[model samples]
Target: MREVAFIKQNKEKWLNFEKAIFNQRFKNPDELATLYIHIVNDLSYAQTYYPKSKVIAYLNQLAARAFQKIYKTRRQETNRFLYFFRTEIPMVVYQYRRYFAYAFILFFAFVAIGAVSAAYDDTFVRLILGDHYVNMTLENIENGDPVAVYKSGSNWGSFVGITINNIYVGIRAFVYGIFGGLGTGWILLHNGIMLGAFQYMFQAEGVLWESVRGIWIHGAMEIFAIVVTGAAGLILGAGILFPATYSRSVSFKMAFKDGVKILISTFPFFVCAGFLEGFVTRYSGAMPNSLSVAIILVTLGIITFYYIFYPYIVNKKMTLHTYDSTL
Candidate 1:
């Protein structure tokens, strides 16, 4: 059917339904729900059948406005933050946990491999770090300032540059998912190896513990964001590899949606990481051991809650309330 014919047939019904809903003419809760559902069904069909049609666009706008009204009037906030933690945050955390875990395992495993390689071959650090960076660090260490590289720039300059660079890396990692995971894995591997080599360099200088306490204040979130980006890549790649119950195109679409959500959420984390690297990392030399310990602990706490604890709680609740349609 033509868009006009469809619109003419349904327009009166839709307008009457809207008036009934807006005018508060519902006889009961069941009637209200039924009306809302009809609106939802019509909206879905209109989008599917006449996606670019003016009627569909108008319907979409109408639905959105109506939804806002419904949510506004029915607002019942029993602590907004608590509600977010109890509901949206947990669900989001659960959805991305797989990607997060993949990122952590892949990066850490690479780090471990780097450590073993460094232990076996003294030249491996030189190979990974290049003679220039390795020699520079050694020279800095000899001067009794092992982490002076961070202080090379103005704080604001470093912060803006670093944040922009990290965000670019994250976006690239996400975009690389188009190659069906290979590209994403390669990007992650490159980063993971670099991180491993960097950390091993510090260890070789006999300052691995100090480096961890000092670097991880920001590195925790920074590295975690990289991992999340890797996970986004994996999610995109996985769709290409195995569409499962969906057609390949449909699966790819869904994967992209999920991956985008995960990637966007990491933006704030990257900014925080940049701020720490610029401000806190530059002060690592003057930082007290106590403050370093506290920061490390806090970083660990956040990682633990987001990666382990939050996901567990979400899955547990999901299992318990399997009957709930929202899941």
Candidate 2:
């Protein structure tokens, strides 16, 4: 593209960013960072193709101004931390919401396959869930405690161990995007199938509701994190596969950054899930059915609202803010 066309294409956006910066109209630092990223990209392009042009100088100035505004804010470090969770992750999630749907669809499909297979063949549950796990659960069921597996370890020990393991799993799901997302898909498939088969096994034994109350106390958040991590992996893979206007390397770099951000954002939820599994799930058998169901529903609601609904809310506010600025 010619310098004039490029400048024309981005001029309004740059002006809007300028207005945002000078007027202090940014919704959050992440919003400023987002605009700065685009400005810098344009500046880089101008410098490369129109080395001696005035447009290059103008973009350089604009980008420098944006940088100063972003970093020189008076907000404390605490505010920055809050902003990351409050605004940054949600914005990123909103930007890549489609990937979330894709991951969920694939996971649900695998879960269905596992459920149907287990329903027809007793051997299928053992095959998917492993002989050791199936055998242990069967023994537990015979002993009248189908979910006794959760009660085996010390609370704090289980919390730390499970938290670390969940984080590791989430990270692996994200890093596997290098394999063009197939690795992440495989991870989701394996886990989803295991989950379905395990549930079906309990259903076969007439303790499906009992199993759900115990498992889903923490499984809601744990499974949601896993699925979101899969979305991050898909985002990374898509970047490599479809560069769009950016070079393949640049696309991959951007995707990796965004994907990593998304993955890191799930760390707190993983810890929460681990805590619930360690402390809450172990007591599910003795707790009232109402309490167990309530916990599961609340956890699911929290994760869903934050990851799915909150993004829409934030984006709407942002859109209105942007439109107001233009007016």
Candidate 3:
């Protein structure tokens, strides 16, 4: 958007924020923090698009003061770890919600591309998944155990190995964002396409149900965490690409901090998914259909709520709680 039009759009909001800062109208530290968030966003825009405008200086000074007030008036929050997970991450995620949309939309589109390409060409799946893996899976399908590969390794060995691998994948996805988010998109594309082709291969073998019962036992949270990590990478890239009112270095530092926090939040989910994959997925064929389905639903629900819905809930409570203090 053009600088003048952008300023015209956020001008009134900035004025109100200025008034709030000067008059001490914001009742709580959270409110000041919230206002600081707004100022920083505007400051980022002005820096990126209106670097030469006087408004960049104006927004920067206001943002700096608001930021100081947030730290100065803040009560030391008890349960720092709990607060980090319960309050901080959710607020950050809410602030960058649009990136989630981008990651999901792009990943799913890539998945569809893989599925379409595989459907038309028998060799596409073998090319993506490797000939040996495809042949093993096909042999397993014929043997009536299409997911036998997951059953290989001792449970503890599998758990530790898989957890580390999943964490590595998440970190790779986040770290790759340093290259302007294209690297992160590539990560998503690689995985999403593989997933699409993998599933389609099972369906073609007439054993999708058998594969899903085992795969989705862990895939739900595992896949969702990857998507969230991809969003964090995009957030990092945005810092480099946008740089609002800050210098490139400063913007990159701020973005890295926020992106790391987001990436760290998914570590627990990765461990959980790893546990399920190592212990439960291998036994999915033996499990009652309802049990397998329940595990998949519960895992999916937990990650979906935490990363997606929970952010809105936390933001709402913060807004209402702080707004009520003024009365």
Candidate 4:
């Protein structure tokens, strides 16, 4: 690109940096720091292509000033942990909202395939859910309790074990994204198939409502966290597959960090899911229909709002704060 065109292309960005950085007057220092990174990159570009031009000198000066603000801000930062959960993760989630959409769409598609295949093939459920599980569930059904497996373990024991297992599954789903997202998709595929087949088994047994009321007390958040983790994995995959304007390494680093943030946000949800699974799901079969349904809806609503709706709300608030800060 010509120096004139390059300058024209980035003129607004440079102006915005000046406006954002000059006074060190922003509510979100993290965003300001991100802007500084861009400025430094622009400085590098100018130094390479416009070494003799005033743009290099200008950008260098902006970067130097911004560096001081970022440095001082970091040393003084007190609410970093709270800010991470409150502002950082939500911003990251909003920035990568489409990946969540893509992940969920792919998950639902895989689930449909699982369900349709099970419907058409008698042994498909056994193939996916394993013989031992099918036999155990069948026995539970014969005894008038379809999900009694959850009742076996002691409450605290169940909670600890289930929490650990859920975290493991979530981590596996996220780390697999290092393979460029296919790994994450495979995890989704594996889990989606199991879920579909599991549900179809209940439906075929003529106790669909019985199973739902029994399972969804905890399944709501458990499954939702799995899909959210899948989205985190896709973010990793996107980092590797599409670096966009960044070098591959830089893109991967950014994606990995964002993915980790996303993964971190899910830990509480997993814990909550595990708690319900251990303490509540075992009783779901005997609970009142109204109570079971309310639990299901509430659990689903909490996770749905956090991962689906809350990101937009948080992002808008941050944008407004940024705009107001500029004024």
Top candidate on lDDT is 3
Clashing pairs counted in every model? 0, 0, 2, 0
After TM-score superposition, the amount by which residue 83's alpha carbon in candidate 2 deviates from its true location, in angstroms, is: 0.6
lDDT of 3 by residue, 99-176 (tens): 999999999999999999999999999999999999999998889899999999999999999999999999999999
Q: What residue runs in model 4 are displaced by over 4 Å at the alpha carbon?
A: 1-8, 11-78
| Cα lDDT listed for each candidate | 0.72, 0.84, 0.86, 0.84
How much does candidate 3 score in TM-score?
0.83
Provide the lowest-lDDT 10-residue window in model 1.
Answer: 318-327
Clashing pairs in 4: none
lDDT for model 3? 0.86
Q: For this target, which candidate reaches the highest TM-score against the unseen true structure?
A: 3
lDDT of 1 by residue, 1-327 (tens): 777787788888787866665566766544554555556677778888877766665565444334433333433246765544444444555655666677778878887877777778889888988999889888887887777777789998999999999999998898898898878777777777778878888888887876777678888888877887888888888878876534798678867876786687678778988898898887887888899878767866785676568756755654343323222
Q: Under the 3 Å rule for N, CA and C atoms, how many clashes does model 1 have?
A: 0
> Over 4 Å off in model 2, which ranges?
1-78
Structure candidate 2, residue pairs in collision = none
lDDT of 4 by residue, 70-120 (tens): 544654336777766666676677768888999899888888888888999
lDDT order, best first, reads 3, 2, 4, 1
lDDT of 2: 0.84
